[model samples]
Target: MTQEAHVTQGPLTTEAGAPVADNQNSETAGVGGPVLVQDQLLLEKLAHFNRERIPERVVHARGAGAYGTFTVTADVTPYTRAAFLSEAGKQTEVFLRFSTVAGNLGAADAVRDPRGFALKFYTEEGNYDLVGNNTPVFFIRDAIKFPDFIHTQKRDPYTGSTEPDNVWDFWSLSPESTHQVTWLFGDRGIPASYRHMDGFGSHTYQWNNAAGEVFWVKYHFKTDQGIKNLTAEEADVLAGQDPDSHQRDLREAIERGEFPSWTVGVQIMPAADAAAYRFNPFDLTKVWPHADYPVIEIGKLELNRNPRNIFAEVEQSIFSPAHFVPGIGPSPDKMLQGRLFAYGDAHRYRVGINADHLPVNRPHATEARTNSRDGFLYDGRHGGAKNYEPNSFGGPQQTGRPLWQPVDGLTGGTGNHPTPLHAEDNDFVQAGNLYRLMTEAEKERLIANLAGAISQVSRADIADRAIGNFANADADFGKRLEAAVRELRG
Candidate 1:
């Protein structure tokens, strides 16, 4: 066999961009002696290799992202003075990520789990991140329960495997999980593809107009491709056959110019209505009824480009519900309040204090000049600027108007106080209403899915408790789930 000559395209270099002398061999003390620490190349390579990967996200670790554009289709200036939505035909760049909630970084993309639908909109004012999920409601309403709920989703420390009993026990104990559990067990839990599912800002957010009037809002990104789901059997088969099926599907579709899009709509309620609303609109576990407040079309989102580098653009990209521009702010939702602090802290630890300085995460239209100075990998753009506020020197001063001022006569003690409930705040009511609203086919599928999951729980008590939760939602839902579980177990 004839051997092709090796071609040297470029010289190997260290991370610092210094030319490498000998990448293949390490310096040693004489021939065949112990390797010397003087070998900078070997030391550098080993050290970097040891720390190559950053810590994966505690949840929604597995994800795919794309570059997109968000175009204002309707005038929302009366609702929000946000520059991005100030006029029709206005467009802003966006990065959207879709992920499975209960999966590790290497887990199958086709798993039957709630999908994340996070978007970062780079507008003229600033970047606004709408961190949300595919489902309209979350499992728990309180931030205090978030850690425990996530623990249940993860593997058991003792067994090093997923524990069905642990999951069922948590769900059963936390009745607020009933609504989300119903959604999860249904066919929609396993979306056919990321493009085929809707995205929702699960918590109520505050939007203020130029006149300082506030409106509570819920965002919905309805897929233009139409809603589609995979049955458990099909999802399981696809998981085995192609673990990265969803990621591949999105990428290939964009490459073929069949760009996926979503129509952006928001359900708005008057600020005064929140005080007398039938339910707590801020509760993450509940959904705003469409009949009460219909969706108002605002914009359209379309994914037109794939990421050039997944690691830099997708993996390092960060989005937070707290990252809001002028005219938009967080509501009094306990979960959203906690997330305002938690998401940024998590990103700082996982990436670095300078994670926001990365090209993908940097504010595209504005300069971020703050007292926050150097940490690891800071870009040194803070060069010679006064790192303190209230100085005479012309540093970046606060420019934008405040979204909203603090409410007057606020009195509250810092404790684990439950959010004051309304006359219709029973956890079971909405869940039951959801079940009653479903068609017979959907109801049957929901029962089968719930049974399949509950039957896997080793503890009979846990299984019974979970069934009781379903009963609390609706008698028929409970009865059917109980029968299905018995048949499956037998």
Candidate 2:
């Protein structure tokens, strides 16, 4: 075969494929200082640049996803009355998304960041999404500071670079972030892959009963594949070699039938316990030490298949802590409250008004009937059915039958008062526990990790302030990290 290559000139086109003319330059005012307002191409380019990125997720943008199934393993109906977790051995389909916090969509997966572990359960009741993360602790305990916390993690708009000063400065000022900051510099911060890591419901949630009893609960999805991690050095090397390693691993494993599975376990506490507990249970930064509340095995989750399409199934899939089935509901964790409202708003902006209609986001078994219709990518055009409810005409009716547990009267007594700070509610305890649990080698690695990151902050005081967070976690851990950071500075 003879090959001939030539530049084929084509007609000029606009950003959306519309034909354009006069491509040389913008319509200029006398070929100098200013451009004419009539130049449509210039307007389009400027407008597009203004909105170059969809609002990046407040957190967990760098991620990978796969489809999975949750098979009921235990009889938990006596504990709570949720249909999906109703019958033992019954299976419901799920889609799981794993992601890195504090990074953009194109950022590296192994960036020494917490990984988001969000799961969507397509149940008979509705789509139940458990949006959690790899780490059980978060940097900030309150939701009010969430936006400011995220701002530090993101790029500095002025410089278009990640500024370490912004990070350490923010954390140091807000001592509440000390616990999560410690975890960020620890061993599990950079997971080897989505398959080899565990997931946690980080915030405590309320699981109510048919008899109107509310139980405080936290979920931990222990990976059957075993929790594995990459040291900072290993993670840095892997990031350069493969930025999409975790995403690829999840996809490949599911395709090969080496399905990754997790044991779904929950620690349930009676709502009354929140008052007398050693720590404030609603605090997102604290964990109920397993000794106080042991993990009870409830079910098995296995990701056996990957999404057939990335855009529709994986990318567009939205999981919010707000989305709960009957028996499950949100706790007063401030972040949880903000998210219950923010997630749906985010989906509206990024995916579209009708993103839920996408198969991955939609309830698989339970039909969605609503009066809303016709937005971008609208799949349901009301289907010739009356859009208005309360119409005498035959229309989809709200099921009067008893379904999911009601949220009324049950949570009324829970009250809106602040969670009283208890003895162990301070952020440093769990961070210290995680540090103490580390092996000597792991401890050394943690020190090295801290040194590596804190050294990048231009100001020495900022670097020292970050080390202060480690100190709060543990005196020795802080001292070791401080010494290491000093060595780097020297």
Candidate 3:
């Protein structure tokens, strides 16, 4: 039989699908001369590479994201008239991004760091984003010290490496970081995976409904995957084998239809009762105990779809606590207030001014209109309408009926002063409670992880300062870690 010549149709083409003249060389003055300016492809390629990296977030640079829906499991219409959570069994489209706060983009996923749990709810009202973290506490409560705190968590200026001495120095000086440091060194510090980890609205927020009723609230996204953890040795091995373990797991699980889910429960307190509470209700490093404010099941959230393109959808995705639909607002937690400003600013730096134009972040409600326009990558059609508001062109206007409550009456101090300190502000109670709840094996693993890591600090003073944090969490917790470090020191 004669073998027919199987001819492949064509040669490679440029982005415009035009036939390329040369694959090897750019248009140049001569064969071995400098490249010519007429080479559009060469210029385009180099220019694109130069702009490849948008600014990385000063924190939460490493992350994994997925598409999901939040289905309301209970009727909380009385507490929050927010459309997504009011109707029982209503499915609200959501995108969740799990992140490690202190690591860079290429850092290990299982490193002992607080994971960011941010959810963007695309609701009928608008886009409601609950920007939170895995742990219900933070190292600092005030916004003013955020830059300084992040500086310590990042690289040492001279060595350009993360130093325990630098981190501990900040913790020692700040004092407010003690509570969160305890949680960070606990078993939950390095979660087994994005699935096994729990998510929390670390700062208290507000939920209000019709009839002028307002309630202070916090959100908890409990992983139905069941909380699990890896030993320090196991995590180190995984990190070496796969730095992108969490990212791969989330994508593969969703692809196999083994969707990860979390039960959404909320702790609510009456607005009137907040002022009289024993602790600062707005403090980020504090949690409302279930005994005092039980978790009212509101819904379930599941991540079922992986991003089609990781960089466009997952990397570029942004969440802001300030992006609330009506009926939900921020609490006065100093950290939360700081985040409200920081989240958007970081997004602006990372994805540019037109980030809102990205599919993942753009508000779903078609009726949405704002004065925002014309920046670096302006894509809006310029509206071809009025640039400013208050025009008689029947432009978008704010509504009066579905009202927004003034926060002036919500927060009260002696005019412009801090609230009086409460006894519960000591910051040790919750940390101690968390320590006592740990299983003997879990406690053992936590102590071992701390001592093993802290032993590398080299400086005796730095190791001692870090070990002292455990002592505050529990006497036994500190003692074991100290003994281990002492042996290593010798």
The Cα local distance difference test for each model comes to: 0.90, 0.81, 0.82
Per-model TM-score on C-alpha atoms: 0.95, 0.85, 0.91
Candidate 2 C-alpha RMSD relative to the actual structure: 6.8
Model 3 scores a C-alpha lDDT of 0.82
Task: Locate the minimum summed-lDDT window of 10 residues in model 2.
Answer: 1-10
- How close is each model in CA RMSD to the real structure? 3.9, 6.8, 4.9
lDDT of 3 by residue, 163-193 (tens): 8777777776665676787677767777889
Per-residue accuracy of model 2 over 1-490 as CA lDDT, tens digit each: 2221221245667867877777778888795759889888989889988965555566777767887789888887766778898888999999888888888778877778888899899999888888899888788776778889889988898998889899889988877777776677777888888888889989888877677678889999999999888887788898999888888888888777898999999999987787789998888888888999999998999988776666666667888777777887877788788888888888888878888888788899898878898877786657778789788888777766343343343343665555459876776787788889989988898788878878888987877777887798799998988888888888
Q: How many backbone clashes does candidate 1 have?
A: 0
Q: List the residue pairs that clash in candidate 1.
A: none
The prediction achieving the highest TM-score against the true structure is 1
- TM-score between candidate 2 and the true structure: 0.85
Error of 2 at 315 (Å): 1.5
Off by over 4 Å in 3: 1-24, 29-34, 365-367, 401-404, 408-420, 458-465
Clashing pairs in 2: none
Better of 1 and 3 by lDDT: 1
- The sequence of per-residue lDDT tens digits that candidate 1 reaches over residues 319-375 is 888898888998999999999998998999899999988988988877666788878
